[model samples]
Target: MTFLKRGVPLGIAFLMGVLMAFQYYVPHEHSKAFLELMTRWDKIIAGFAVFIGAYSLFHLHYTRIKRRAAGWGYSFFVFVGAFVTIAFGLYNGGEAFWHDKKEGTMFDWIYMNIQVPAGATIFSILAFFMASAAYRTFRARTVESTVLLVAAIIVMLGRVPVGALISQYIPVAADWIMGVPNLAAKRGILLGVSLGAIATSIKIIFGVERQYLGGGD
Candidate 1:
């Protein structure tokens, strides 16, 4: 506290912090330069942040192995995954001076064939699980709950032709749910979210928030 309470860090933080906040409102050439400087600073900080995360990943596994913690094998899994990906992604093709050989092609293969299907499979299970959970937990506990459960079921069936064939009511209900009620609710949510974002941006501009600058304790 003694050193930092009265140091160069405090002065720089106050000055840069003012420019960071004011750049959002100020329209002069000076404000433009300040904004550009902040943008570059952001990219530089992000690069260093990535390095810090990588170091954390490496250190965590190394410590696990050193301590022989239970389920340490899982840590090895992370190490193996990272090493394999890096190895294939680096040496699979000849490298250009600047062009990345495996970034788009090889990594994308791993993502699509493996990650995308896994994600979809998990998402597909949600319907069955939702039905079971609603049946067990909801049980039409109240008028509001009953309405919610019915609405969920109707929307779920509306996506498929089978639902329409089974009952014509489903398609109509789904149309109302999606076209009117759901759309209105989504619009309200989006508007609220936008307002929140604008408020946060203004706060950062005014230096009311310094969490992003690593200046917080």
Candidate 2:
């Protein structure tokens, strides 16, 4: 039981990790073939994972509805939306499953009218939240904060055509700040993330990171 729970998965992970890592350095046909095979396997696994995720979501909503939990009414809408979307998708608007959905199809209509608007509304709300956060954080209390506040104001105004109309140098200075300091900082962040990812991958490959296997299981 212990071997079945741990050894088999660990061994498989180690082998696959080593094989996938070699695909980067080895310029061989076998490596390419293995990579292609693994890519297909990834898609198959992801397809299975989708079912798992959907079941989990539905189970959560079902339990909430059953228990008559607070805000359980909202879960009813979740089920309704999921069913409606799935029904439209499977109906395929009177077309075959393999055929592409037409622009005027029910699925596309739902996506454009319902999904797109909801997503846009959420993002619009986020913009206001961001503005509030910026107002709170961008105080000119210290030298660093003052510099940040000034740069933010310059960037905000310079992006607009009125900034150039008001003063030619405003846009030029904004471009300089963005092109030099902003780019340098972004590169440094990317370097740090890349290093961290590499280290984590190394740890996982060596079985030093067993966190992926649920802890205390």
Candidate 3:
């Protein structure tokens, strides 16, 4: 059981990772073909993984509904929504899944009316949450915090037309702050994260990181 569950997966991971890493440096035709083959395999595996994830989600909600757990009513709505969408999508007005749904169909109607508005509503709610977070975060306690608070305020104001009416300098300084300091900081963070990810991937490839195998004896 240990050999089948752990050893085989570890060996495959090590080999695949090393092969993919070397493929970057060795730009031969064979290497390119290998990469293309792996990419196709990845897509196929990803499709199966998606089904697994969807099954897990539905199973969780179904259990909640079956147990009559708290907020089971919401779980009921989840089933309703999923079933309605799937029914409309599969109906497809006699068209196959690969083909686009014709306009005025149930699927198209639900997407434009229900899905789009729900997404927009979620985004609108997120704005209020962001404002609340900014309020808590941008307290002018220390010198660095004071500077951050001021910069955030400037950026917020400068983004709107009212800041121009207040003072031209406010907009100009905000633009300079964003263009210079913000860009430089962003690039530095990106480089740091990229290097860290490369190191972690190398460690995983070498089997120095075993967390992916799950925790057990």
- Candidate 2 stretches greater than 4 Å from native: 96-103
TM-score of 3: 0.89
Candidate maximizing lDDT: 2
**Cα lDDT tens digits for candidate 2, 131-190:** 999988778899999999899888988999999998999999899989999999999999
- Please give the TM-score that candidate 2 achieves against the real structure: 0.91
TM-score of each: 0.69, 0.91, 0.89
Per-candidate clashes, comma-separated: 1, 0, 0
Candidate 3 per-residue lDDT over residues 26-131, each given as its tens digit: 9799999999999999999999999898899899999998999998889988889989988889888668567876667788889999999999999999989999
Q: Which ten residues in a row have the lowest lDDT in candidate 3?
A: 93-102
lDDT scores in order = 0.78, 0.91, 0.90
Q: Can you list the residue pairs that collide in candidate 3?
A: none
136 in model 3: Cα distance from truth in Å?
A: 4.5
Write one digit per residue (lDDT tens) for candidate 1, span 1-217.
7456444455566677666766879889988987888889889999999989988999999899889999887898888877766665665545632455545566567767877998999999997998787778977879988887888879989888988998998989999999998999999999999999888766665556556656444
Local error of candidate 1 at 83, Å?
Answer: 0.8
Please name the candidate that would achieve the greatest TM-score relative to the true structure: 2
Worst 10 residues of 2 by lDDT: 95-104
